[model samples]
Target: MKQVEVTLNVNGKDTTLTIPPRMTLVDCLRDELRLTGTHVGCEHGICGACSVFLDDEPIRSCLMFAVQAAGHRITTVEGLLNEDGSLSDLQDSFWECHAMQCGYCTPGMLVASESLLAENPDPSEDDIREAISGNLCRCTGYQQIVEAVQMTAKRRREGAANG
Candidate 1:
């Protein structure tokens, strides 16, 4: 097997690693960088469990090769935190709303929800549903997830208005 060096800007940090060309982005993030918040589910792109942000856009890490991610920004689930190391508003809302049951899909859910909220701060229920439709969750019946996103949006709006 041949090894290639690639630098990935993840979580606002740049990390260079020597890896095989065929290694998936998720594997590189977890195995090499040790950022385990991004889970590996189906290995296929359909599960959405391996979702992450590629240049602030939601993408399936499992479907991309590590070498292919070179020179691009990758934000894993662990990156979606406050600079003070506290949970982000969306994460806190997920916890408050009990949006996760098994936790396997929470990371992807957070990524999807965060991306949606970034584009549409005050998303309606239908908008929320459409945004998160790509990620599947067996627990919480998705209602809590939707509510969590709604809570985060409302809080952000209130914070902006109060300022």
Candidate 2:
């Protein structure tokens, strides 16, 4: 296989790498970029563990070729962190609400939840459920995840109102 040079804008930084055309975006991010936050569970896109933001929209990185991601902005789970290197509100909420167990699905859950919150500042429980439906978690039973999103939304709204 011939290697191709691809420039991907990830976590607001542009990086160029020479990689095989068939390499999946998840593999590229983990292996080349050393962004191991995006976990590889099902590799087949069904697990949603490899979710990341492609141009600010949630996508399964496992389903996308590295070459295909060229010229697109990618935000891995690490991108959701605060600029000061602290946890974002959503991440904090996940921790406070105990939304994860074993932690395999956390990256995808955070990406999906953050994407949902970005679009809908105040989402109902059903809306959160619908938004995260694609990601599966065997532990935590999902109630805690929903609570985490709700907690983040309420905090953000409150902060906005106070500020």
Candidate 3:
């Protein structure tokens, strides 16, 4: 099998990998790099289970090729973990808000919402919903996810103001 060497920054670390041209970003992340947090659902970008942060932006990993993201920065659910391996505040908010059920979609939801909060530290409920529009959650009914984003944004803002 032919492979191409690709270099990218993942979770603040430099990564150089060789993958087949046909391999999707999700495959590379999960299979090659062992970042299994990015799920594979539809594999066609509609399900959003393979969502990840590409250079601080939310992108559907299943829709993109691994080589296409070379030199870019990718953030998976593992990246959301704090230095001590504890959950981030946004992660805690997701739990506090009960933003997920079954938890299959939680990682993608966090990637989307975290990217949204990065762009807009204080996001409205509508903004939160719009940010996660591509990601779907069947069990959470969407309300808790929206509230989670809102709550996270509020917490981030408060922290920024205090710090």
Candidate 4:
């Protein structure tokens, strides 16, 4: 198969690479771009482990082709941090709420929660639950994850009101 030249703007960096047409975005991120934070649990897209933001919306990278993502902005878990290397509010909430175990699902959950909060900053518990429905977690029983999102939302609201 002939490799195609593609451009990917990942985490605010524009990268150029040659990739086969069949290459999935997950493989491109992990193998080519070295953004291994995006894991491949089920390459068939059933698992949300490969979730990332495509144009600010959460999408399963495993289901998309590298070529399909050209000219678009992509944000992975690695992008969800402050310039000083501090975790974002959603990430901090995860740690404060103890929302991860084995940590395999944290990336997806974080990205999902980030998307949810971006659209609905004052999300109700039910909204949080519905937003994270696609991501699966084998630990924390989901209570902690939900709590983390809620807490982050509350903090965001507080900050907004005070500012």
Better of 1 and 2 by lDDT: 2
- Per-residue alpha-carbon lDDT of candidate 2 for residues 1-163, written as tens digits (9 for 90 to 100): 7998889999999998999999999999999999999999899989889999999999999999999998889999999999999999999999999999889999999999999999999999999999999998978459999999999999999999999
What is the alpha-carbon lDDT for the whole of candidate 2? Answer: 0.94
Give me the runs in candidate 1 sitting further than 4 Å from their true place: none
**Candidate 4 stretches greater than 4 Å from native:** none
Ranking by lDDT: 2, 1, 4, 3
Tens-place lDDT per residue, model 4, 1-163, is 9899999999999999999999999999999999999888978977688899999999999999999999999999999998898998889999998998889988998998899999998888899989889888866459999999999989989999999
Top candidate on lDDT is 2
Cα lDDT, model 2, residue 70:
87
How well does each candidate superpose onto the true structure, as a TM-score?
A: 0.97, 0.97, 0.92, 0.96
Alpha carbon lDDT of each predicted model: 0.93, 0.94, 0.88, 0.92
lDDT of 1 by residue, 1-163 (tens): 9999888899989988999999999999999999999999889888788899999999999999999999898999999999999999999999999999999999999999999999999999999999988888866469999999999999999999999
What is the per-residue lDDT of model 3 for residues 35-148, given as tens digits with 9 covering 90 to 100?
Answer: 898899989978788899888888999999999988788889999999999999999999998988888888999998888888888888888889889888878458998988
Please give the TM-score that candidate 1 achieves against the real structure.
0.97
